[model samples]
Target: MVDLNAALRPADAGSLQPTAARPPARLQIADVSLQYGGKTPTLAIDNVSLEVANNEFCVIVGPSGCGKSSLLYLVAGLTDVTSGTIRVDGRPVHEPGSDRGMVFQGYTLFPWLTVRSNVEFGPRRKGLPKAEYRAIADHFLEEVGLTAFADSYPAALSGGMKQRVAIARALANDPSALLMDEPFGALDSQTRTVMQKLLLRVWEHTQKTVLFVTHDIDEAILLGDRVVVMTARPGKIKAEVPVPFARPRSISLVLEPEFIALKKRILGLLHDEIDETH
Candidate 1:
């Protein structure tokens, strides 16, 4: 069994100073709820609250229709909440801002642009110089291992490759936090695994706070520092499980007994929620 103590110990203080010194951009969600209105008003999320610290990789998981993605969208300011508030570093989030970056399940690339241009889109919109934005795009393209495909259009890339570009484009904006909604759900299992590992590498290197939503428990366990489980529709926080396995993790870690045990615990929590709904 891996030593939980060692796994949970804080990263070296000296080595972490660079990221630590940056202004705090902790994500805070307080008493948040979302509803849709028409002839039939539907409550999708009910008083859900979550906080993701800067540089933390937090994943949300729940059974289908549990509003996991809805909660993320609320934080991204893509949709307004019916009640409560969300703040980043103490500033209220009223709408989408450059401070928050989003990546969706679909590769939302600009079909007309080459990979390089797509990645540079955000920086360019911010009025960055041509040379400066190009350099930023180049840096993230290399970070995502797509330097060779910089000139390729979205249609020319594979699904996994397209998602890599999506990731690069989001990072190029240098958002305070990254909000991803099932970014790899459409990929094959092998490709999904590769992308998961690639994301960990980039997260560690960039130290960006991430709030990712997925239905895959294994992906949650493999990638998150803490996995937030939500209950069935009108979703609420069911449990928060800390992933104590050390970082620099591999896919093989999933086969470990500890990993399996943790998976079972989370599954039971999800099952209980599903059972309640039925």
Candidate 2:
């Protein structure tokens, strides 16, 4: 019998301990709320606050329509918050900027662009020297194991391959934080698992701050330093469960007893929120 409560304890600041010269949070959200205005205003997110440390990987999970994706969009500056603030590296986010890179569930790649071209889009847009941007694209393409497909168009690649290009494209921009919203939601189980491993490898190498949104509890645990659970619609922070596992994690971690205990605990939390809604 594992102590589920103990397993879900808040993460110790072991690796994240701040010093006098430490930088501000890489990503910060304070009292964020999003309400769609109309005859009947609908509040999607309510007073949700979160902070992601530099190089930390945080994942948000919740039931359907819980505004998990909405919160991520607010951070990406794709939608305005009704009230509150979102900051990246101590600067407020007003609109989409090069400082943040977004990857959606859909491939969202330009069909006409080849894999290398798609990855170079951001650097090219920033007026980087063609040679420099091409090098950047080549580097990330290799990182995601897409070097062989560099010249293949998005139409020529499979779903998993397209997403690898999408990730490579996001990282090429060299954003302060990587924001992903269910980026693997469209893939089959086997492909999703492979992408998960690939992403972990790239993330370990880049060490970029990440805020990923997903409903999959297994993924949230496997990929995040902290798993933030949101309440039902009109989402609010339900809990933050720190992952106790050590890094350089492999798929086999999922088979361990500790991982199973944590999953059950988080699943229970989600079930409670769901029950309240009905």
Candidate 3:
């Protein structure tokens, strides 16, 4: 069977391998509810409570408009919750800040900035000492394997490289949590696959808590420690299935009996919703 519990985790310096630490309580969504400008507020998300253990890679997947991204914006505090609470390390999330870094689908890197400059943007905003922030930027750029392109402008790199720069920028600040909103949704299959491997390696090294939102089931099953499925707008948790797969996962594994089993299981769970959406 696909081993779900073998997700990439933080590693120690002595060996470039995942080293377990006290589980980080990276993000908590406790009975949160929200909606847009509708007078009734439409209840876009209803009482969603989720716990992402420290450094865990949790993926939220569902059909389009299922409030997956809404849940992310709430956790990142880009929008306020109507009723419940969102806590990161026991503190309420009221507004956006550097503690949580966000990577959007579009490669939002400044076209005019060099790779180093883009990664350095956040720490520079924090007004740290020049040398310190520069070092931080250099480190993350290298971590994401973009060191050779440190001086290249966003316009010069391929789509995959641009995303790597974006990821480096987010990690430069060393945020405890990373929120990705369909970050790989636009890439061609080959580039997307390459980027996926790059991300797992980065996570293996950094161990940052990740809350990923995607509509792709294969991507979710391949990358997440646990997959949380949601229903359509006025979204509610439809299923919360822990991914039972092994790490260093690959496309080849998807054809395996265990991987096929989990895929069927999740698809079966979503069959009703998919049909209803038609």
Candidate 4:
């Protein structure tokens, strides 16, 4: 098992530590819905309610057009809900606040910025002192094992490395919740496996509330403490499956009997959705 804290430096003075005893943040999405309007308005997401426990890694999975990502957007405060509310740590989310950090499938890094500078952008933008943001950037880059590439630009990195930078950049902000939308979907199988382990290690170390959206059943089952499967368009919760595997999960767990059984069950549920779509 990888020990994430082993290689990292201590948090800067007055910064939150990975093992700090702060109250873990909880995310609640209640009766949420989203509709895009014009001549013919379309309801993208139906009445959906879900609660993610403090520091829990919750993964959402479904077929394409199921509005899994839309639900994520609502939580990130990047889109307005047609109706309903989203709360973070009991406070209603009205706008995109630093409390929520998002990592999209595309590496949204600034092409011209070095990896270190890109990670520091959030803190600097918030008017943090140079020393504080520099420390923040260094801590996260080290945690992601990208310290050596601090001066490297995005265009010079591989897909996996770019995503690593993206993850580092998100964490540099020290958000209570981390929202990821198919963050590893674009990687090849080999690289994706490595990234998964790295992500689990990061999640274990940071203890941030995670809401990850993915289409792969295996990936969802492997990462989430609970996996919520959605129905077809105008997405509503179809089923919520709890992952029974132990923590510090490895890719090899996918070969185990328990993992195989859970995968089949989720696949069965998804197949029904696909049938209805046709």
Reference-based lDDT, each prediction: 0.88, 0.90, 0.81, 0.86
- Summarize candidate 3's per-residue lDDT along 8-122 as a digit string, tens digits: 2211211212226436456778778886775664778877777788888988887777788988998888899988899988889999988899999998989988999999999
Point out the worst 10-residue segment of candidate 2 by lDDT.
10-19
- Per-residue lDDT of 1-278 in model 1, one digit per residue for the tens? 76554333333211212244333448888888899999999999998777788898888988899998888888899999999999987899999999999999998999999999999999999999999999999999999999999999999999999999999999999999999999999999999999999998999899889999998999998999878888899888877776888888898999998888788888888899889888
User: TM-score, each model?
Assistant: 0.92, 0.94, 0.88, 0.90
Tens digits of per-residue lDDT, candidate 4, 175-277, equal 8899999999999999999999999999999988999999988999899877788889989888776676778888899988777877888888889999998
lDDT of 3 at 144: 83
Residue 55's lDDT in candidate 1: 91
Across residues 126-230, which tens digit of lDDT does each residue of candidate 2 receive? 999999999999999999999999998988889999999999999999999999999999999999999999999999999999999998999999999889888
Clashing pairs in 1: none
lDDT of 1: 0.88
Q: Which candidate is the best by TM-score?
A: 2
Question: By descending TM-score, how would the candidates be arranged?
Answer: 2, 1, 4, 3
